[model samples]
Target: MSTAFCFGIRFPMFICMSSFAIIPTSIVVERAIALWKRNKYEHYGCRLGFAISIICIVVSLIMSAWSMGKMNLSDLTVYCSATTNETADRITIICFTYCGIDVITLSGMAWLRTSNVAAMKGKYSDLRSSYQLRENASVIRVLLPLVVFDGLSHLVFSLGGGVFLLFRVHFSYVAYRTI
Candidate 1:
């Protein structure tokens, strides 16, 4: 049950954070693709991107609620933990899934950032166009690194939990710091 509590928190969090990364990164990706394809009628990408983001958000929320339901004890301590075979498997799954999403989303964001920043270095027709491009580029430059850093820390926490589960290691500080 304690093991359940540990994963109950982590899986939901991974789902939520991964969704956050995927949604915006996906929008930028879609826009980049539209520009690459020279498609003038690309407003549809906004709608499609929003639709996918909504679906991902809703699904993540529901899953989070479902996992919370598994935590039956009202007075359960967040610090409580356990190591067992089941937990090892759960940790492995969480780590792999989290890393997979991190790679896909962060890589897409990096690509989008590179393409837009590259375009910003080229000629823009007007002052307003240049200003907006530079602003967008700046935002991406600031945000993507933060996202990558946070995601990498999450990966470390998941791996730490996995090691604890499999080897009875007491690296619970990873969870404490991360959570």
Candidate 2:
């Protein structure tokens, strides 16, 4: 296929995929921040969340542009394949970055939940504070599994890619090779 055709297809695909991966994490982080700063977040949460989403989109666009620039389009053959070492490196970096962010956010949420529970023990009225704590706990309980799953999936994929790259094994060959 022509280089233009390949670029046209791949560039948008990259942007969409990157945005999909990043936007959720950004929203989850925003929620965690809201949990931490309830007062300010209550007033400005919508704008703040919008800003974070915009930042994520912009970052993904920049990354996609940089990655597309690094591609050796001149070498296109029968099909457009982003199997270069640079592509592999970029994927690994992106996956690991996602994993790292997930870990930090998860830890922060856990800490916030614990500290708030401890602080509210005797300092505040059990009725109101307990209800708030229960709400926070429920949010945490829902978020914890989703974040852990996302992080673990990214971690596993990145590690697998790293191992394959280290061993100089191509994924297509491994996955599609004849027995």
lDDT of 1 by residue, 48-134 (tens): 667767877886665444434434343444454322322345544544555666676667777777787787778867665565566
Query: After best superposition, candidate 2 residue 46: deviation in angstroms?
Result: 1.5
Give lDDT per model, in order.
Answer: 0.57, 0.62
Clashes of each: 0, 0
Across 40-92, the per-residue lDDT of candidate 2 in tens digits comes to 45567478867997899898888777656766666554556444544656654
TM-score for each of the candidates:
0.53, 0.70
Q: Looking at candidate 2, what is the lDDT of residue 13?
A: 80
